[model samples]
Target chain A: MVSIAEHTPAPGRAGGGRLAWAFVERQTNLWKRYWAWELVWLMYGVVNTLAITFIAKQVGNEGAASSINVSKLILFLLIGTLVWAYLSAVLDDISLVVTWERWEGTIEHTLMAPVPRALHLIGMSVFGVLHAVVRTLLIFAIAVPFFSIDFGGANWLTAAVVLAAGSFSIAGLAILAGVLPLLYPERGAQMSFMVQALVLLVSGVYYQVSVLPGWLQVFSYVSPATYILDGIRGGIIDGKSVADTWRTLAALGVFGTVLIPLGIVTFMVAEQWAKKTGKLKRQG
Target chain B: MLDELPLRAAGVAKTFGGGFDYGRLLPWRRDGHAPEPPRRVVDDVSFEIRRREIFGVIGANGSGKSTLIRIISTLLLPDAGEVRIFGLDVVRDTMRVRALINRVSADPSFFRNMNALENLLFFGKVYGLSGRDVREQSPRVLARLGLDWEQALEPMSHLSRGQQQKVAVARALLTSPVLMLLDEPTTGLDPRSKRDVQSFVREVREEHDATILLTTHDMEEAELLCDRIAFLSGGRIVAEGTPVELRRTIAAGRPLDEITMETVFMELTGRSVEEDEEPREVLAHG
Candidate 1:
């Protein structure tokens, strides 16, 4: 056997990209183990989108449906539900970062390693984005034929760009919410879900933001999901080009630019405080 | 030389509980509103480890040995005082200090779903090891700790407690840390596995020139592996010296062979090693 001394890595920092990919790999391995749960969530999303979007068809078939365009309403509901699915998936994945560590009982070991905090978090965010994308695409594929929607005029490329652009801001917000579990292990997971619920209510996942009361509109302005939902609806349901949706794209870019750094700094502060308070160890 | 000391801790302290909480004032107090005092888990502890020395801290469960190790390893910040690794302050030079240190504690956590090879490879990457290096080297380290290479390919959750402990040991050694902190690394291992880990620790120091600070409750294991041992009671070091020196100090002219490390510990702490733990619930009738 080779002496451990001979194989010791030289003292230095791990590559940021390699460490990030390792975290992504870790999540992928976890997905492989619990794929049944993943499929269950996928099935639940498909059922949910179908159930909600069919409301439009029911309304159109009503006796007072003289002015209802069943196809347009179905498209509207489909885009709303699908966009909500994608947005919520990203939020849940990012916010559960700390919860996942605690459940696995690996919080102490992972935090004690020599890697920088930013690299660790960014890696997790990268995984969250990729995982959410794959899961959302699967749901979309399953719902497409079931809904019987025509793909004739929808600007698919533009919708994809909008979804991608909105993801960064969602990642930032999720990172911020992830700090709750680190700070208050007992109620932190619930608190993170509450934050997600707030984003959902204010982001117009099922209705237009203008329909919200004036005070609630402030939250919608702050939520990147509002812009995301609007941009996605315009691209897919209204068949708008990227040039037409550039305002929402730019708004998302601005939110990402601001929130990512803010989230990182805030999470770091909370993490340092947790360490001083001895909260890094898994609490019963 | 002190300049090259692998570990130095001065007046390190960590207290648990006693922070202000509204819940404590919720009429559950025991008569007359007396609040619970903060328990100092690591109380004004001070120590230094010279380069390549294997230092042992012997204590019963809950004697603060693990807390002291955590403070030195930069896992938890000390409430007061400071720790330095290779003369770099643990708090201010945390990243550099972390690069120099690695720790193996009791019940070392891993990605249980992944095989030992996968877990080690992830940690190896965290320690900056290349993929090829981790794949080639981790198996050899596992074999040295008496874990079969084939068995290491199974999920860590499937391994025995002792086998998992060996994997933990192997993980720490994979980084070739300049200062290795073993907080009860073999506490729950079987005898054979214990000996495997013990001999592995010895070989690591000899071959890698790694300095080790080991905390354990096993008296014979301490005497066998530690160049010097410190007996801790109630979060304080009651005695510290070479094993033989500690035995002879209180031997009172008795035969040296008759005075064992257990006796030395009993003499210093006023309790047997088995009874050294601080009882949690004090019996009281009010």
Candidate 2:
């Protein structure tokens, strides 16, 4: 048959435009089969919104309000949960994709492609974020009336940018976790669990960073997760004037820029090391 | 069709790192990612593939066949080597290497949920194939592969293994690359699919003016396809020449009909290797 993957005409292939379009297309295809992940995240978003609303109600006793008070407790909880949910895979599943590919005996195939190795991993992360966004949108559509939220015009597009940048930064951490297997295959599974635990305990997913001890708080601030949460919280829930969130948005942007490049570079170095050491076949 | 050389690697040597050095022919001694060991995968390996030349890399597993192909395709760097495609260094000029080469490994991954056409469209954009051109051209490619046009819309998971392998080959062929790296492209195929893929390679070389670098463990495949054969053992070339010349070198005493590759292999290495035997373990190497 005629070749399916012929190099299309160029001028388009130069610079970020082509690569970004490639990634965006790949992510869309990836999300076609992501209904299960979508379902789980939707339920999780609901569960989190409900759980936080109850917790805040208890903090108020006979009607005491949150430190960050809001008349609609459910809306506040839902907004935070929906936005931060993008961090789940980064907080945990980065290594799992490799482990998953290794177990399936497919990573070798991925490596064989002429495309750079980092693109596939980053593509997976971008796809995961896209999947998360769909579920978050679904939850918003369903829960809007139940929570009686006035999500009207309080800077929704800015909220999306801040959340996306934050999540991508965390995905960089996830990508780093993913490359550990290529470098240290046997340690891969263990490291996956350890990273997930760290994200859970230290990233302040369930509680504020201040809740952790001082040293742990310092570590959390260093986490890409912290910037993600800070950006999302600052943009969506806080929804203060843009001037109020300038610092948080900037921090998220800086982390976003650094995270992807750092992760890809680490992946490249580890891949070079693995091939040299015959680790590809062993791990596969 | 290709009057000029498309890919060239001169004095190419790939070394294993860490613990084991597999190069027995070009032995050196050193450490820390340096080139002081003899377990060179492509020991001083030099060759030039002209455009449209179906150059094949044939050797036993661990004989550095795949390693050599990978290096040419810019997947791995050589320890003491230089690979240039139209004067572009595979190392210093990686983006160029990628643009010039389209590699189809033994296996390829596709989205399980998407049909063959969907996967093509996805990768089409990756190669910068976009818009109506991608949508219209996908089915034409699929049809050429003998896939039913309707199958383009079916989920990939429902397809047979042989069919999926075809998709992998199709993805590589889709790009019409200047240099094609086929690493055991037919390793898992049935005899028929194997022939189909082999024939496709031959066709592409003829029609597209592409240069092909293929690696395989099957001697029959090598004898049937490769223009020049290199007997690689222990990560170095023990012998390399045209099949007739190689057979003649070993046929000095034996009849031509009896001078199969097995005899030639045994004559050089003093060990008879068979495709059936699980081959040597990859041996943890540095």
How far off is residue B182 in model 1, in Å? 0.6
Residue range A166-242, candidate 1, lDDT tens digits: 99899899999999998898999999999999998999887778899999999999999999888888888789999
Residue pairs whose backbone atoms clash in candidate 1 = none
Cα error of candidate 1 at position A228, Å: 0.5
How far does residue A206 in candidate 1 sit from its true spot (Å)? 1.4
lDDT of 2 by residue, A102-163 (tens): 65455654454445556666666766676666666776666556544555536665666667
Q: Chain A of model 2, TM-score against the native?
A: 0.76
Candidate 2 falls in which docking quality class? acceptable
User: Predicted candidate 2: interface RMSD?
Assistant: 6.2
CA shift of B61, model 2, Å: 2.9
Model 1, residue A226: distance off in Å is 0.6
